[model samples]
Target: AQTVTQSQPEMSVQEAETVTLSCTYDTSESDYYLFWYKQPPSRQMILVIRQEAYKQQNATENRFSVNFQKAAKSFSLKISDSQLGDAAMYFCAYRSPGGTASKLTFGTGTRLQVTL
Candidate 1:
């Protein structure tokens, strides 16, 4: 069984600053996919970034990036130049690459608060 964990329940960062949200997962499968999803007050889960387990390079998208430590089963999200719009609940998720019916296992989200 695979499980994702987010130790931080909430986080705060000043505008234009940076923040890192920690996440870790336990999985026996060698091939899988990790993802970061953001849910704003609207409650819509939007994909932030994704990393393939077989890839060594960390995934990056604009101001969002991830530090994926495969050996440690850690996948942390880094938001650079954080903005007020970035305030949301961030969730780390995992999925097996095996079947089309595979479901995503998500972590307890970390709520991000951006201050001026």
Candidate 2:
């Protein structure tokens, strides 16, 4: 089992700017998958990016990228070129690829506000 924490409950960013949402997790497992998901007004769970705990390199998806610190159990999302469409509730989640592959632990959430 893992516990994910999102320190910032809300963050505001100007249009076309950049913003970073922080997330940290506590888990005893050595192998797992960390993820960043976006839920907009429509309430759609969108996969922003993901990282493997054993991988040293961070995971990136276009303007969405993660700063994954395995040792520190930190996985943060950096949104570049922020847009109106980016405003949403972001969640950091993790899932062990073992027998509990069906389970996913998610953080509270971080409300991102993209402004003009």
Which candidate tops lDDT? 1
Give lDDT tens digits, candidate 2, residues 34-54.
Answer: 889999999999988888888
lDDT of 1 by residue, 3-90 (tens): 9999999999999999999999999999999999999999999999999999999999999999999999999999999999999999
Give stretches of model 1 more than 4 Å off.
none
**True-structure lDDT of candidate 2:** 0.92
Query: Candidate 1: TM-score?
Result: 0.97
Q: What root-mean-square deviation over C-alphas does model 2 reach?
A: 0.9
Error of 1 at 41 (Å): 0.3
Model 2 worst lDDT run, 10 consecutive residues: 95-104
Count of clashing residue pairs in every prediction: 0, 0
> lDDT at 70 for candidate 2?
85
Q: What is the TM-score (0 to 1) of candidate 2?
A: 0.96
